[model samples]
Target: MKKILMQLKDYYGEYLLLIALAIVIGLIVGVVDAYFGMILLKITEIRSLSPFLWIPFLPLVGLFIVFMYQKYGKTSSQGMGLIFEVGQGENKVIPFRLIPFIIGGTWLTHLFGGSAGREGVAVQIGATVAHTLGNKLNLMKFQTLLIVIGMAAGFAGLFQTPIAATFFALEVMIAGKFIYPALIPALVASFVASTTSHFLGLEKFQVYLAEPFDFSLFHFLLLAIVGIIFGVVGSLFAKSLSILKSKMAMWFKNPYRRVFIIACGLSVLLLLLYQGRYAGLGTNLITASFSGQHIYSYDFILKLIFTVCTLAVGFQGGEVTPLFSIGATLGVVLANILHLPVTLFAALGYAAVFGSATNTLLAPILIGCEVFGFEHFPSFFIVCAFAYFFNFNQSIYGKQQILK
Candidate 1:
């Protein structure tokens, strides 16, 4: 205990710095997330007011995203690939020029009814801030750790799951090895960021559930089965997106043409499925997941199709949020089939499938506990472990390396 206390005292200054940085990053991320959300909401409203006018122009939005990438997104290197590059010994600092491109491209994607998540945009912004700070301060390896911490901070600030965000930053890069030394900094940053976001009145995602029922043997078996199904669904989702991306690359020699093709395809599909549902980030579906209401048995399949196409088409966003929407809805459907509690199964599905898809175990379990409460911790851990192993090396971020 004395040794531990001394170590804590020694690292107190570093912890304080991380906390301060996290607060600033979190506030920035929170404002960006909220602002982007509001902007998307306005664009959505505009499309609603005149679908004929907006729908016809949707393909142009895709073209604009392609144009932005051709012009200014060269430094991004595509999606989270750039993050891995920085983490794995590349001095390829994220330029501030890429920030506007990411924010603008993502906003336009959603504005024109592209299906994607906001977390990707927020994360890139957070990392950019850290990278810029590191460059300006000329900090060494220790400062690079701040880049990772900033990722956790941004994610926590946006999602309001600080603990999960901490682990996510640690877990996202490699499997089987936790970066134990970074834990203190990551956690401190996450807490500061989450606190800052809350102070700024950004709301956390909410779920309604009855008390967790007793963990019966039968229920556990049933959940395990549901987890297995989720594993398959999640794996398929990841594989399909990868395949589509590859195929698109092969089909169009021009990157812009590939994006245009995807946009046009999505427009046609959206028109056919014109409920004005399953468009954009699918936040409505995530909200409905908790209630286990209004979700058809096939909702997951539809979401899977739309998300795969949207992401495969080269739009900017993270897969985790859409995965959450897919998992929760599927869990509800599975619960109904197995005669289990809808809310309980939905929560399990949300975490486990996300864990499976992302090749993350603890982060998703923590996410479950953070979002649903500690009472579900044991169940969440069990299900997520099952799903994670069952999926075995599959990942939504294809560039992630499996260490272990």
Candidate 2:
């Protein structure tokens, strides 16, 4: 007891300060994320009402987006890469402009019917705010740790999934490696941010799965197979986006021309395909998947393609939400084929596909439980374990390093 008491006494000061800092970060980030997310949602609604009004101008908007980057973006154009570099100690600072640039760029992307997501922007916003504050406070040695706290706050604030956000911030920077040192601060930040955002009226997407089924050995095997499929789907998404980005860059050899021409082509296909069904964040597909509406078997593939092309051609947005939509829709198809409960598997896919793509394991499992119901955690755990193992180490964050 003396030894334990002495150790606690020795570390209490530092721990207490960290906890306080985390709370402050969470509160500030939560408000910022709430405002950003709510505006984006409103933009999505307006676009949904008349996709044709804005989608036709995608090419023009693409040119303007490209111009912004060319004129003043500098290292900011690196996007998530900048965050990874900072986390890895390869970079010391994240430019503050990254927050507004990404938020505005993503808003423009969705408004113009581009297929993309918002989490990436939210994360960048959180990291930039946290890192900047840390720098100002002269906590130079603790840069990476502070960034992790901010990242957790950002994700939790946006999704209202604190546990999942905590694990994601800890594990995402290095595949298969968790930063135990930052766990406490990350947890505190995530929970505080989640609560703040919820109170600020940022709605969370959740599906309470009520179907009951025994976890028989046969059921385990079936879920394992589904996990593998989701893993491969995630693998394909990361690989395709990376390859397409390179090919488009090579083919155009000019940023302005690339975004303009590709955006034109994308605009046509998006409008033609079910009258912009694959537009925005793929939320339509997500809604359809769980609402007992028609989810075409080809829906997932089209969303994946459109998202890849949209991002590859320089459209600004994140990939995570679309990935969730893809997984949910694909899960519906798999459930039909495998004769399983559609909603349950849809919930599973919503988490698993994201796990596979991000090369994250625990976050997806916890997210599944949090968003669905903890009662189904056994199923999510088994499926996510297999999905993580089978993801082939693919990640959407190219700058993320592999731990040796």
Report the number of the highest-TM-score candidate. 2
lDDT of each: 0.75, 0.91
- Runs in model 2 lying further than 4 Å from the true structure: 1-10
- Model 1, 67-115: lDDT tens per residue? 7787767877465777666765665667777678877777777667777
Instruction: Spell out the clash pairs found in candidate 2.
Output: none
Candidate 2 lDDT for residue 74? 80
Candidate 1 C-alpha RMSD relative to the actual structure: 2.9
Report lDDT (Cα) of residue 125, candidate 1: 71
Residue-wise C-alpha lDDT for candidate 2, range 320-348, written one tens digit per residue: 99999999999999999999999999999
TM-score of each: 0.91, 0.97
Worst 10 residues of 1 by lDDT: 48-57
